[model samples]
Target: MKVGVISDTHGLLRPEALAALEGCALIVHAGDIGKPEVLEALAALAPLRVVRGNNDLALLWAQGLPDVDRFEVQGWQVLLVHDLADVPAHLDQGVQWVITGHSHKPLIERREGCLYLNPGSAGPRRFSLPVTLALIEVGADALVPEIVPLLAANPLKATSR
Candidate 1:
């Protein structure tokens, strides 16, 4: 199963991001969506799972939207959260991956026995950071994820000398 991971959009959705997420079975929004339309747009692509971030507190989320959620996909347990600090110490239910987005920096790390992923800020650029997103593919026995950066669709050209 292919899962698209994104976060910290802050209301700007790029067509590149949408294209990268096409054909994904599920889309995970880490937070800071900025508006309901963001989710609506993603829902058009695939089933979406979301967590309310600090910036999203003012928005209305579905009932029982918790700080963390455990999702089982293809027999692998994946944990979804907005903040890494909120991670539970023990995984009694068996978690293979921990997905979170808060710092707006894309990350793919395998710590201990689990994977930690952050799709970064795919919306308006923050500081000097590049816009990026991630795709996670869970095979029957293993999980593979890739972080991809979104480049400007049009690059500036140099003036004639």
Candidate 2:
């Protein structure tokens, strides 16, 4: 299964981001979603699983925010969390893939037989960092995670004042 992963969209959901995610079997938003409409937009494309970010108010997003989520896709046990620090406590949960977002920097690495992925920040540009996301391909035995750089959503030039 192909799942589109994104996070830190501080209210801006670029057309390019949406276009890049089209036709994915599922979409996972790690956090910092500026508005509920962000989830709504993604749901229109496919089934969505989202976690509450540090900036997201539970009351404001009572219907959408989830602290932690665990699900199986294509035979891979996937765990979703907003912060990486919260991972160690749950590391023993038997999840093959752990996904999180907070720093807005895309990362893909395998440690101790588990895959860790951060789709980066797909929202407004954070400093000079490039807007990014991720694509996860789950197979019968292993999970392949790719850090997808959002070329069209470069915030460096757009945010220059």
Candidate 3:
């Protein structure tokens, strides 16, 4: 299964971001989503799962969104949260992945038996950070992740686990 992971889209859903997410089996938004239209646009692409970020707390449309979401995909337990600091202290033992956003920094790392991924900011540019998102290929045996840069000048590259 191919899963698209995106975060920190603070109102601006760049056309490049939507293009990169095309063909994904599922889309996960880690939040800081500035508006409801963004959700509508993403859901149009694929099934979407999202967690509300701190910024979303003030939005009436985001009131019903959860701060954390847990699910299993291809037998891998996944936990989604907007901020790493808010991750529950006692996580379920089987959770294999923790997806988060908020710092506008793209990252992929494995620690304590779980893979941590942040797709950076797909909204407005932040500092010099590249606009990016992630694509996760889930197979029966392993999960391969690739970070895709949205800027034309950066080119596309794959980062594996």
Candidate number with greatest TM-score: 3
Local accuracy of candidate 2 as per-residue lDDT tens digits, 32-111: 88888998999999999998888886546645567889898887778999989878764756787889999998888777
lDDT of 1 by residue, 82-149 (tens): 88887787754688888898898888887777888888898899989879888877788777887878
Q: Tell me each candidate's TM-score.
A: 0.88, 0.88, 0.93
lDDT of 3 by residue, 1-161 (tens): 99999999999999989998999999999999999999999999999999999999999999999999999989989999999998877778898889999989988888786888898889899899989998899887677888888885454444444
TM-score attained by model 1? 0.88
Residue 150's lDDT in candidate 3: 85
How many clashes in each structure?
0, 0, 0
Worst 10 residues of 1 by lDDT: 152-161
Off by over 4 Å in 1: 61-64, 152-161
In model 1, the Cα lDDT at residue 44 comes to 99
Best candidate, lDDT: 3
